[model samples]
Each structure stands twice: as structure tokens, then as C-alpha cells.
Target: MLIPYTVKPRPDTGLINSKLGIWLFLASEVMLFGALFSSYILLRVNSVDWPVGSTILSVPIAAFNTVVLISSSITVIMAWASLKMGNLSKGRMYILITFLLGLTFMCVKAYEYNTKFHHGLFPSESTFMAIYFTLTGLHGLHVLGGMIVFAYFWGPGAKMWKTEPEHFTNRIEIVGLYWHFVDLVWIFLFPVLYLL
Candidate 1:
């Protein structure tokens, strides 16, 4: 006698295990980021001389990236809405746009990091530079991860708009959650690190 397995796709449960698992994952991510931010606050209060961020960081560039990231959130929403309406092509188009925005985020981030290094804002500069690098680098890695997810979602091999539309919808929602978190963090970072 052998145990039987049910591998049938479960669309009835509303995107099956994807959304549930993604939410759990997102919750963990929130806690992880929360710790980082808390550490930033604690260390900031301890430092007598914080690195001057305004002279080092380019607010114009970062502000532009913020807009791009926020716009990607809109793109993901459009994709999800289109999928709900059974418009697979439109959904896929919006998903592709989201991926482009994610790519733009990475490109601009890489350029900014390079500029910081050129200005002698290395890890050894001060405690502030260390915090800056760690926070922004973590955020950049999240952007990279989003790009990876979007690459799979938008790829022809994924059959996103064809065979597994519900699965695609779940993927979009998870990506959207991650995108919104990224944008929210940047909102605080921009004013604190760039403006203040």
C-alpha cells in the first residue's frame, strides 16, 4: 500500500498557498527591517558626530528613485486588477512595466553607491557611513530580489497570462507587498538621510 498525493492546483482557495505563504514571509521581513531601523535609532543617539548626509547624498537622484519605486507600485496594482478582470495580456504588460521600474531602481542605486565611494564615504569613514551603507545596501538587495521575481513572472516560460493566471495573480500581490514596503522605508530614509 502507498500513500496518495493530491497535486491538483487549488484555485478555489484563492491563489492557493501562495498568498498565505507570502504574507507570512512578508511579516518576517517586516520584523527584520524593524530591527535594522531600531538599531539605526539607537546608534544615532549614541553618536556625537554624525556624518553629514546632505553633502554626500544626492537628494535629487534619490527623490527620482522614490517616484520610480512608487510608480512601480501602481504598475503592480494595474497588473493585479487586470488579472482580476481576466485580461491576461494587459496584466502581463503591467507586470513588465513593474520589472522595468525595479531595474531602474537598481541602476540608480548602483550609481549612487559609486558616487558615495568616490567621495570617500567608505565603510571606514564613520559610524554614520556604516549605517548608511548597511541600510541602503539591504534595500538595494531587496530591489534586486524583486527584479529576480519579476523576471520570472514576465518571462515567456512562466506562462503567466496563459496556463496559470491565478498563480500569477498571487505572485503579483506578493511582489506588490514587497514593493510597498520598500517604498515606505525610502519615505523615511529620504527625509532623514537626505533632507535632515
Candidate 2:
């Protein structure tokens, strides 16, 4: 059976089903990441020797990835706006741009990881390394997950736009919210893990 409130807002709650679902999902994600951040802070503060993040990591590369993610955030929002404006092709183009930007961020991260491995800086090398890998690796997986969703909407999922344009737009909006959160996490991570 077709789901009610997929596109329309519910009477009890002003959000459509997917919008409400994404917000709830994001709340849980906040807790998951919050626990990790809290643990990292406690560990670092307790340790006698914590390496300066900039000394151990490539700030320039991380900064570049930051720009890429921020750009993707903008593009994803633009994609939603384009769809809302009834421009399917334009929206799809923006979505493709966002996907590629995410890909770029992952590739840069892979390069950074390879460089670390080349220098023999494995997680076992130090506490800083361990947390660094854990945080970035987890964040990378989130980025990859968003890419998978974007890919679906850009490819086979585009078919929905033909018959159910409004529904398709709502789907894009929900995905955009998730994408923005991923970007925001990196914004926090960049300074915490790289600068500090």
C-alpha cells in the first residue's frame, strides 16, 4: 500500500514522513558521533603526550577536502532548489556535481591514508593515530553512504521524477539534509583533528 504523508505533512507533525524520519535518524547519528568526540576529548586531555594534529596530518590536503565538502553542500541544496523549480535536468546536473565532489574528497582521503601508511604511521603507532583513523574513517564511510544514495537518485531513481515529480523532489530534499549533516561533521572534524 502507498504510504501516507510521503509528500504531504502529517496532521500531528508538520513534517512529511521521510523528512521526519531523516531528522530522527540524524538525532541518533549525533549521539553516535557525540560519544566518539567526547571519548576523543577525554583521552587527549588525559594523555601526557598528544601530538599536534597539524604536525602529524596534512593540513593543506584536509583543507582542500573541506572546500570540496562545503561545495558539495551548496550543490546539493541547489539541486533541491532546481527540482523545486521544475527543472529536472538542472537538478540532475547539480546532483552529479555533488557526487563527483564527494568522490574527490574520498580520493584525497585515500591519498592521505596511503601517505600515512607509507610513513609507517599506523593506528597502533600512537593514541592520536588511532583516534585520527577512527574518526576520519567513520566520516569517510558516511560520505560514501551519501554518495550511494546520490547515485541512486541520479540514475535509476530519476525515473520517479517522470511520474511523481513532487515525490522525487521530496526525496532529494531528504537526501540533501543527510548530505549537509555529513558536511557539517567534517567542518567540526577538520579543525579538531587537523588544527588542534
Candidate 3:
């Protein structure tokens, strides 16, 4: 059986099925991250001797990651815009750049993690380290998931643009929304975990 409203908006909700689904998912995500942020605040506030973030983390590396994520976010938007303007080749190029930027961010993060491990800075080393690892690790997982989806769309999924152009463009836009969220989370994290 064919599902209704996969691409077109529903009369009552004015949202296609996938668009509505992503928004609902993002709402739940907000709550989940909100709780984690609240916990971080409480933990930091109650600690008797909280180590400064700059002292424990490499600010320069994180700043570089911040730039990477920000650049990826820009590319994602450009990819969607190119698709909307009926430029499939341009869209693909922008998305490839976005994917490469995401890969760069993950590589830098892995290097940072390796450095921390070599220095005996495991999560169990301190309260700040535990929260830091938990928050950044979870965020990294989101980035990985986004990249997988982007990769699929960039490769085999490109076939959809030939058959169902509108749906394919919508899919790219929806993924862009998700990519923006991931970038925003990293923007918040870079400062909170690296600067102060």
C-alpha cells in the first residue's frame, strides 16, 4: 500500500510526512539535550573544585573543529539551494564538500581523543572529563549518523534525483536541517567545553 503525503503536504497539517516526522524527532531531541545540559550545569555548579575547560582541553584544535563544522553547515545550505534551483551537479558538489568537512571534523576529534588518552585523561579521571566525554561523544555520534545519510544520498541515492526530483530535493533539505542542528550543537559545545 502506498503511503499518503510522502512529498505533498497534508491538508490539515501542511507538512509532508517526512517533514512532520523530522520536526517531531527534533522536538524530542531538544528535550534530551536539554536534560543533559541541565545536568552539566548542576554538576559544574556543585563541584568543589571544577577544573577550567581551557586548562584541560586543547582550545586551538577545538577552534579548528568549530570552523570545520561551520563550513559544513554552509555547504549543506548551498547544496539544498542548488537543488532547489535545479542544479543537480552543483548540489552534488556542495554536498561532497559538506561530507568531506564532516569527515575532517571527526578526524580532528579523534586525534584530540587520542591525545587525551595518551595523557591519562580518561573520563574517569575527573567529573569535568566525564561530562565532557559524554557530551562530545554523543554529539560525535550524531555527526556520524548525519554523514552516513549524506553519503547514501550522494551515491546510490542520487538515482532518486533522476526519477523523483522533488522528493529527492526535499530529502536533501530535511537532511540539511539535521546537519544544521548537529553544527549548532557543536557551536555550543566548542565554547562550553573548550573556552571557559
Candidate 4:
């Protein structure tokens, strides 16, 4: 038997199963990140000495990653739009671009972490470093997760398009929503962890 609301909207919610599921999932994610952010704020406010973020973190590198993430967000939307417009090849290309941008962001973050380690700056060294690592590291994992999904949809998952184009397009839209959220989180992180 076919799954209900896999393609068609549920009359009561006007959303497919996946769409509603993603939004709900994102709400939980917001709470998770919100708690971490709140903890960071409390820690910083109560601490006797707090270093200015820009003085410790590399603004240029963080700025570059911000651009990369924002660009990936655009590319993800373009991928969904391409599929919606019946352009499979273009959709695949955009998905590939989005994946590469995410990969670039991760690599840059890894390099930054390496540089910090080389200088003996670790999470244990200070509360600031601890929260910085916690925030960015978690966000990095989310980016990696999105990249994995993008890779799948760009490769084997593309077969779905041939058999169920609308369903595949809807899947792309769902992924785009998640990708946009991930990017939005980074936009908040860039200033909070790197400039504040």
C-alpha cells in the first residue's frame, strides 16, 4: 500500500507528511540551539573576564564560511526550483554546487580548529573557547548531515525523479527547507561566536 500524504497534502494540515515532519523537526532543533545559546550568554555575562570574540577568532575565515553557507542556501533553493521546473540536469548541478559549498565550509572550519590546536588553544583553556567549539562543532555536524543528503539525492536518489517526478520535487523542497535552516543557524553563529 502507498503511504498517505507522501505526495498529496493532508486536508487538515495542507502539508505532505515530510513537510510537516521537517517543520516539527526544525522546532526541536531550535530549542536545542536555543539552550546552548542561552547557556553561552549566561556564562559570558557572569564571567569575570571575557575575551572579545574577534580578538580570539579569525573574522576573515568566519566571514568566508558565512559567505559559503549563504551561497549554499541559494544553490539549494535553485536546485529545488530547477526540479520544480522540470530541469533535472540543472537541478543536479545545483545540488552538486550546494554540496561542494558545504564541503568547503567544513574544510575551512577544520583548518581553523587545527590552527587553534597548534597554538594550544583548546576548549579546556577557557570558557569562551569551550562554547565556541561547542557551537561551531555542532553546527559543523549539521552541515555534514545536509551534505550527505545532498550527495544521495544528486546520485542514486535522482532515480526517483524518473518514476515520481512530483514526489521527488517535493523531497527536494523539504531538503531545501532544512538546508536553509542550517544556513540560518550559521548566520546567527558567525556573529555570536566570531564577532561578539
Best by lDDT: 2
Residue-wise C-alpha lDDT for candidate 4, range 123-192, written one tens digit per residue: 9999999999999999999999999999999999999998999999998999999999999999999989
Q: Write the per-residue lDDT of candidate 3 for residues 1-196, one digit (tens) a residue.
A: 8667878899999998888888888888888777888999999999999888999899999998999999999999999999999999999999899999999989999999999999999999999999999999999999999999989989999899998888989999899988998898888888888887
TM-score of 4: 0.98
Task: Give the per-residue lDDT of model 1 (tens digit) for 1-196.
Answer: 5211112335666434555666788889889778988988898889897766777788899899989999998998998899879887798788899999989988998999898888887978887788788888888888888878877877863484476666667667767887777788788877877776
lDDT of 4 at 36: 99
- Local lDDT at 130 for model 4: 96
Residue-level error in angstroms, candidate 4, position 66: 0.5
Please report, in order, the local distance difference test score of every candidate based on alpha carbons. Answer: 0.79, 0.96, 0.91, 0.94
The superposed Cα distance between candidate 2 and the true structure at residue 72, in angstroms, equals: 0.1
**What lDDT does model 3 reach?**
0.91
By summed lDDT, which 10 consecutive residues of candidate 4 come out lowest? 1-10
For model 2, how does the per-residue alpha-carbon lDDT over 1-196 read when each residue is reduced to its tens digit?
A: 8878987799899889999899999999999899999989999999999988999999999999999999999999999999999999999999999999999999999999999999999999999999999999999999999999999999999999999999999999999999999999999999999999
For candidate 1, what is the lDDT?
0.79
Clash totals for all candidate models: 0, 0, 0, 0
In model 2, which regions exceed 4 Å deviation? none
Better lDDT candidate (1, 3): 3
Residue 150 of model 4 has an lDDT of 95
